[model samples]
Target: MFFHIVLERNMQLHPRHFGRNLRENLVSKLMKDVEGTCSGRHGFVVAITGIENVGKGLIRDGTGFVTFPVKYQCVVFRPFKGEILEAVVTMVNKMGFFAEAGPVQIFVSNHLIPDDMEFQSGDIPNYTTSDGSVKIQKDTEVRLKIIGTRVDATEIFCIGTIKDDFLGVINDPAAV
Candidate 1:
């Protein structure tokens, strides 16, 4: 799931950046420092959309840098349990397969796959049905439900399953 929320941060600006165009410099620095960063509470910060408020700068006694309380609107991606998402298969092995949904990495254990599908090992490993109709391999797009989530300070990992109806392979890159 993606969310557009307002967040606050204390941005420190150097004495040299206190002249004209300071606001632009601060905004650019905020984008560089905040974008692509993941927090346990907010998931992954996708983009810094716009600035909401910039509070008065506070100057320290000795340090030449000034700290400003900044509030900004941004977009974030957060996955939750029971959320169905379409992800691209990145790797396949006997144990299971790894898929990526946006910035989140999902692991689908072999047991979570349908019972009718069997794992086949080869130059291009894959899981396929007995009839060879449905195949899940590298670059395959699958619809899976997130069973669990592990949110780290900087990364988000998920356990997913494709055993339910209407879930599983959505697109095969090889078939294209």
Candidate 2:
């Protein structure tokens, strides 16, 4: 899921950036430090949309660096258990396949795939139904439900399944 939320952070500004361009430097620094970062609580920060407030700067005694309390509005993506998402397949193997939905990598094991689909091993490995009407291979877009998630301070991994009704291939690259 994508959310627009406000988050607070303490930004440290170097002494060289203390002049008139302080605000611009601070915003740029904040973007560099916060964007593309993942946290257990916030998932991944997609982008820094706007600044809500920048509190008074506090100077450090010895380093001369200033710390400012900053509040900013940003967009974040956090996937939860049972959430349905459409992702493009990146790899396929006997064990299962790996797909990516934005910043999250999802693994759909063979056990979770429908029994009707058999794994075919070849130069172009794939999972196909008995009739061959449906197939899953690299670049195939699939709609899957996340069964489990492992959230770390720097990354988020998900286990998904497409066995349920209406949750399968959305677009087949081979068809195109």
Candidate 3:
């Protein structure tokens, strides 16, 4: 899920950025520091939207850098349990397959796949139904329900399942 959230942070500005456009420098730096970074409380920062307020700058004793408390609005992506997501399959093996939904990587184990599908081994490994009508392979877009999720400092991992109805391949590159 994507969220528009307001977050506060202390931004440190270098001496070179003390002139005019300091706010612009600070915002650009904040975007570089916060965007694409995952925080346990705020999830993954997608993009900085707008600045709410910039507090008075406090000068450090030795470094001479100015630290300002800044509140800003940004977009974030956070996945939760039972959330259904469509992701492109990246890899397939006997154990299961790996798919990516933006910055989040989802793993769907063989046990979570429908019983009717069987894993096939070859140059292009895949899982297909007995009739070969339904298939999941690389570049396949699948709708899966997140069973579990873990957020780390740099990455978000999820365990997903497609055993239920309406949760499976939505698009197949092979068909195109």
Candidate 4:
């Protein structure tokens, strides 16, 4: 059958009745439902499939494991503290700067930005400003420390502090 034709046929039906029908159809197909004599509709699921990224150490998230080779789920978490890692600046915020390394956006806190660098309006990650306008410089690299994390329903945030050498600008011999 054509898609639009099917949609048109459904459109002719009553909205409330259509909704109930759809719900019942889904419950019957996806869930094992029983219309009991007195208990009313009882839903049961002995098993289900095609949930997408579940079971056997595979995480629902697309990212792989932190330790390497062994893959796991991604959530707002800190796998290792004070671990030295390299990252590029993706964004700047009042609270801190977020850098992308692997699948994680590590945070470099405000106090972590070099104290010698002047900031406008006390902005965090203190960007170099000229003529009263703030321009974000791309490709700025910094080492970060895993300090905190904020996990959402779908994404994981690794908050960090750049207050130490391991989290600050790394000495690059090539830059010299």
Q: Which candidate is the best by lDDT?
A: 2
Question: How does each model score on TM-score?
Answer: 0.95, 0.95, 0.93, 0.42
Candidate 4 Cα outliers beyond 4 Å, as residue runs: 1-79, 120-136, 174-176
Residue 126 of model 1 has an lDDT of 99
How high is the lDDT of residue 172 in model 4? 70
lDDT of each prediction vs. the true structure? 0.95, 0.96, 0.92, 0.44
Model 2 pairs in collision: none
Candidate 3: tens digits of C-alpha lDDT, residues 23-50 = 8999999999999898766678899899
After superposing candidate 1 on the true structure, give the runs of residues whose Cα lies further than 4 Å from its correct spot: 171-176
Clashing pairs in model 3, backbone N/Cα/C closer than 3 A = none
Please count the clashing residue pairs in each candidate, in the order shown: 0, 0, 0, 0
**True-structure lDDT of candidate 2:** 0.96
Q: What ordering of candidates by TM-score runs from best to worst?
A: 2, 1, 3, 4
Taking the tens digit of each residue's C-alpha lDDT, what string does model 1 give over 41-105? 89999999999999999998899789999999999999999999899999999999999999999
Give the C-alpha lDDT of model 3: 0.92
Candidate 3, superposed: residue stretches over 4 Å from native: 171-176
The 10 consecutive residues of candidate 3 with the worst lDDT sum are 167-176
